[model samples]
Target: MAIEINRITQVNKAALRLPNQPFKRFGTLLVTRTETGWHHQEQLSDQTFEQTFPEENYQLSAIDAAGFALGAFEGSRCVALATFEYDFHFNRYLYLADLKVDPPFRRQGIAANLLNAAEPLAKAHHKRGLCTIAQGSNLGANRFYLAAGFHIGGLNTNDYRFTSQEGDTDIYYYRDF
Candidate 1:
C-alpha cells in the first residue's frame, strides 16, 4: 500500500499522542525514546551520530519537555521526525532540532512535510522565528534545509566539544515566519 503522512497535534506531559490506526494497520509507528540512561549508552556506542547535535538527554529534558515534537508516520511506522525548542540565545526564537527521516524513507519528502507541520506551531506560540543547526559534514542535510527556506546564519565550531566524539562542526540556519 502507498504510504500516507500525518501530523500529531496534541502533546500532553511531554508525549505527543500519534494516531494509532494508520500506524497499526499500515506498519507505521512513532517511537519516542527519551530515557537519559538509554541515550547515554547509545551515544557511547556511536559518538559520531550522537554528537552531530545536542545529546538526547538535553533534547529530552531541556527541549522536548518544554517545546514541540512532531513525527511523520507511514502506516504504523514513523518515517520522519522534527523537534523544536524555544531558544533564549536567539531572543526566544523557536529552534528546530533532530529532524530525521528513516533511511528507507529519504527522498520521499517526509522530512520536508514534517518541517511544514512545525511552522505554524511556532507562529501560534508567538516565537521570534525558527532555526536549525546542521552538522557541517552533512552536505545533503545542509542543502535540504537551505532548499526548504532556511538561511545560513553562522558557524558553530566545536559545538559538541564536550562530547567524546572528535572533529565535528555545526552550522546554524534560520527562517522568519
Candidate 2:
C-alpha cells in the first residue's frame, strides 16, 4: 500500500478521530522496583476488549497548536496517527502523546512510517529524542515501540492507582535521535 504521511493541521485535525477497535490482550508487563532500579516481567493472559478515548476536535486542535501531529493516509482516508510535543519537564525529548493505527491497517508499516515522518519535525525543534508511555498490559504496543527503536526508560506501577486500571503499570519508552 502506498501510504502518505502528512501533518495534521487545525483544519484537518478531525482526521485524527479513529473508530474504536477491539484487540486481544495476550499479557501484561509487570514492572517492579528492585534494589538497583526498575524492572519488568511479563504475565500472560487471554482477553479481548475495545476501548476508546475522547478525541474531540478541540483537543486535536490543541495538540496541533502545542506541537505536531501526523496522519497516515491511504488515498484520502486517515488510517494511522501520531501526536507528539516537547516534554516540558524533560525539556529535551519530544513526548509522544498518542499513536493509533486502524485495525485493518495493522502490520502494514503505517505506524512506522508515521514515526519516521515525525522524527524530522522533532529534530527540527532541537529535541534529543522521542519518548512515550504505554500501558504495561498492551503487549502489542510495547513490542512495537521497542521495535521502533524505543527502549524502556522508566516505569510507574502507580500510574493507574485507584482506578479501574489500577495495577496497570505505565512503561515509558525513549528513542534517542
Whose lDDT is greatest here? Answer: 2
Candidates in order, TM-scores: namely 0.63, 0.87
lDDT agreement with native, every candidate: 0.57, 0.80
Best by TM-score: 2
Q: Model 2, 1-177: lDDT tens per residue?
A: 588989987667667676545556778877667778756667777665555555534376577667878888888888888888775455688888888888889998888888888888989989988888999988878878888998887888887998998878889888888
Model 1 has an lDDT value of: 0.57
TM-score of 2: 0.87
Instruction: In angstroms, give how far residue 112 of model 1 lies from its true place.
Output: 0.9
Which residue runs of candidate 2 sit more than 4 Å off their true CA positions?
A: 32-39, 54-60
Clashing residue pairs in candidate 2 (N, C-alpha, C atoms within 3 angstroms): none
Minimal lDDT window, size 10, model 1: 22-31
> Per-residue lDDT for 12-119 in model 1, tens only?
222232221111111111112354311101111222332223224333445446676777766556666667776536464688756766566778887778777777
